[model samples]
Target: MAYAPQEVVDVVRMAACLSLNLGTPDAQRVTSMVSAGQEANLRGIPVVLDPVGYGATPFRKHLCSQVLRNVRITVIKGNVGEISQLADAGGQVRGVDSMPGQIIPLAAAAAYARALGAVVAITGATDVVTDGRRAFAVDNGHVYLSQITGTGCTASTAIACFLGAEHLSPTLSPASAPAPCPAPATAAPSDPCSSLSPDPDTGTDPSAEPVPDQIVLQPHAIPPATPDTPSTAGPNPSPLGATCVTAPIPSAAASSKPAGDHEPPPYLTAVVAALAYYGACAEEGAE
Candidate 1:
């Protein structure tokens, strides 16, 4: 059955993230994937691409090229061979399996990330995640994970979930964040002789009442509004139905620019975290 582009677009409109898989691609599926990816991009939703078996066939390679050219992918996740193909390092892949002794180096993975302007994840015994600058290695998965089917695809889903949570969730920018409440003023010491007559009958001075050692005025803390919280921070800055895509994949030269001393980007961090979590889950499952 042919896939409907409009239907795919509609689904992506309501989705926090869009994941495109080439495991079973057909002409109609490819069209749908491209349409959905573009729609996701327009809405600023994260897009995760799993180029499964990218180097196994010419058709698959062509499809991968088309998607990369058109869609603004947030993450490109695949096995070492698949990632190597994208990086132009020319690794070997038989069917869907990554051939041994053809691992893509960390530097090559980072270079591919730079060229694509997205986070690249190469899964293996030690998964590598990079955003062209900072690189991270996740060594938490079990060897048995390689024997399971769809594990790589599952990793892509996890990364998409992490990216969606990071990007789609409403956050208070520095400008919109509420300022801290000021400290309350301390009461001045009461004057002893200010009152003309102490207390006509009782000789005790009314103004000289004892003051507590420390007057603590509690400031009511205003918790930041979350997505579920009522009266959110004046509509989310990156609302789900936003009109246009804020960040598209840049050119290789543009993306290759130095990142200075700033920390890794949110999308890169999300990818790394996802891989770590997925690997940990695999280890538990093996046990």
Candidate 2:
């Protein structure tokens, strides 16, 4: 059954994040994936893309590149062979499996992250996750993880889940947000020029003689009466909708302090934590 564009857009908007995998990729899947990914981008939803078997065939590589080009992917999870292909470096893949000597280097992974402007995760014996500037090496998981056909696909899902959680959490909590905006009274002193009013006691020429009842009221001089029915003259400055209080965004250096002094960023923490959890579970299953 085909999905309506509005329905797809609504689904993307309501979702916290999106995960796309090309394990069984085809023309229809590629079209749908691009559409969904673009909608997710428009809604500011983080997206995780897993290019399964990317180097297995020329068609796979082309389709993967097309999707990446069209959407602003937040994170990319792939095997060493797939990432190597993406970097346009020498890589060998035989039916979706990396060749024995085609391991991806940590430096190259970091470069890919910088080039794509997205988190790059290259999984192997030593998984490397990078955001261009910082590279994290996670030495986790069990050999049995490789034995499983969809572990990489599942990892992408886990990463997307963590991203979604981080997106939902407030970047600046009450304790870290800049002090509440000062009361309107103290925002700024009334402008001296605007506050200046006509003085009835003193004439324009201070030395001039004062004359009683000299001030003649003009037709526009009277204060208009408040209409019983509120005036709808034009646009209202403060509309009836929700009132938003905008605060200056706290700088990263200032907001870095956590419950503990050295906690990592929420998304980084999530990635590390998810990898650890997956490793623990895989080791347990292996045992």
Candidate 3:
């Protein structure tokens, strides 16, 4: 469906997370994606980017770079070749598929994550997830997944869902909750000094008015999804089964900064969980 840029922004305002996929990008779609992503960032909604076939063409690379530069991405999920190419670490790609036998170092992935300020997930036989400082390897998928199309996109969607649930849930701590956007400032007609000239005795300048009270734009409360919610619950059982098992890797001591100086974002755990679940699903489907 074609969405105007304003419509895209409206949709993103109510969304808990936004996912931008570069599978079959066009100029209009790219424009909408960037607009929606900026809106998502303003609302503190998580944004997931799937740079599909990023290394295949100059246009794809440029589009991916555009999104990365314009949006503060929460998670970036792609195959090893795509991630490697994006990180400038090095890998071969034949169209959208990663060439077999290429070895992109895990450290490269970590460094890329640090540089981009987003969690990076590289899917392969042994999936790798990292935030530069900490990393994890998830071994839970089937080889058959490689034969399928759109699996990478689906994985990115899953990560967005998990992040949305965590960030938008009512139970989230107030300190960590996404801050509400402030409404556009308008001249307050009721301001006593708004139209008043500077008084001779009491120096009050109408031009130099005090800041008006800003109206916090509280988004409409979205009810938590339940089993009864049709949108959240599919009409039929999903062919891809759901399961998750993750093993955390020890943090690399590469940073000169002291440990615990900065805690990893909560979305890091969400990305790991999503990948583990997605890989397990693939395993079950292949079985």
Model 3: pairs clashing at backbone N, Cα or C within 3 Å: none
| Root-mean-square deviation of every model | 21.5, 26.8, 19.5
Off by over 4 Å in 1: 1-3, 171-265
Question: How displaced is residue 45 in candidate 1, in Å?
Answer: 0.7
For candidate 3, the 10 contiguous residues with the lowest summed lDDT are 237-246
Which scores better on lDDT, 1 or 2? 1
Which window of ten consecutive residues has the lowest lDDT sum in model 1?
236-245
lDDT of 1 at 123: 84
List the pairs of residues colliding in candidate 1.
none
TM-score-superior candidate, 2 or 3? 3
Tell me the TM-score of each prediction against the true structure.
Answer: 0.67, 0.64, 0.68
CA RMSD (A), model 2: 26.8
User: Native-vs-model 1 lDDT?
Assistant: 0.63
What lDDT does candidate 3 reach at residue 213? 34
lDDT of each: 0.63, 0.58, 0.64
